[model samples]
Target: MRVSMDLELKDIPGQLVLALKPVSEFKGNLISVVHHHEKKTPRGKIPVHLVFEIKPDHLDNIISLLEESGISVVSVDEKRYLEHGAVILIGHIVHTDIKDTIDKVDNTGYAEIVDLNLSMPRVNRPSSASLKIDAVSKQHMSAAIELLKSIAKEKDLLVIEPIGIN
Candidate 1:
């Protein structure tokens, strides 16, 4: 799973390394790290934002190690969406209520529209959009695409799904 964590480290030498050691010890793949050395929290601790991928079961152990090392964990967010797929939609996207279309997918709880790029060549002409969808698994991705296809049909839009989506 992908995890995002907000950590507060004491403003001292080697504190950043001390905080990240636990994550590395647990074999977590580091995705990103943002260290706010110039910015201090109200408590005077340095703030760090970390994004990494690790086994879900190892999260607690990492947290314990960080606390033991004097690192304060502010928050943690886990993203369960592990599968991604893309589709091209050609239609009157803006006119069809883009928010409603995206809401339908997100409302399912298992999937969401992560990215969208729309092109409008001329006013009142057909528009094209590329959408990136993320879900917990490939099955959920397929279901989301199928739902999008059904929505497109009702809206008189064209859904150009990626090849071999099945």
Candidate 2:
């Protein structure tokens, strides 16, 4: 399967090789690599565009390995991140690693967080967040909600699920 990946690597010697190591390690068929050195993010990292083909099953490993090596995966193919649903999570949202929470859904391959709005009353208290998650279809959206519920519970957050979804 053809997969697209956007990565940001730390600007340093050998960073490019370190960035491409994961793809080659996974035996992925390389399609292209667009290294944008002139463009730097707020953190001064360089953006990289990678396209490759690999067995569907190898995707998770490739992603995991790349992340383990400290590459920031900005985005991946959202093939199933089309159908959507919204949910609200209330609690220590920021303290609990909000990005990790969003990643939990996005990594599922069937869903991703499309948008998020957070309301914080004070700098030191819990907050409420509204999130829109897109999935492959309505059923996938439901599954995404289920996954969100599980993650939220683990983080001691309260979940206000979809109105009409059982």
Candidate 3:
């Protein structure tokens, strides 16, 4: 079986090698790797295109191991429906339990918080953050966003949904 994966790796020494090491553990033969060092992906990480050939039965295990290792596999095969989205959460983000809100999205399993940027004016003052979420499908992405929105409403925060590019 042939598999193509797009991954984001840190731009540090040995990061590429570390990303490729999982292939060998899964009995996969490395075919090609296109590493871009000059340009970073939207998520501000090095983008790597990797191709490998492995036994069909080992595919799932290999994917699981990659995800478990904190490697973001942006795409696999030809499926292009994977959703990427961002939202802005306004109000007392830090005081209202930021970690708990992040945990809610992370615990869903269908989505992940890929990036966060927070700004606070003063202690007990209003704060806001931009959260980037990645999910398997549009529905799951929307569900995750809605979950955050609900939590924000309950905590007296404001959720600005689908902060898309024009």
Q: Estimate each model's TM-score.
A: 0.56, 0.51, 0.53
Per-residue CA lDDT of candidate 1, range 13-81, in tens?
A: 999899889999999999999999899998999999999988778999999999998899999999888
Global lDDT scores for all candidate models: 0.93, 0.86, 0.83
- Name the top TM-score candidate: 1
Ranking by TM-score: 1, 3, 2
How would the candidate models be sorted by lDDT, starting from the highest? Answer: 1, 2, 3
Q: Give a tens-digit lDDT track for model 3, residues 78-164.
A: 323267898998899988899999999989877888899999978878998999998756777889988988999889999998654
The segments of candidate 2 whose C-alpha lies over 4 angstroms from its true place after superposition are 1-80
Kindly list the per-residue Cα lDDT of model 2 for residues 10-85, writing each as its tens digit: 9989988987787898898788999999999989999999988766678888889889989899999823244678
In candidate 1, stretches whose alpha carbon ends up further than 4 angstroms from where it belongs are 1-77
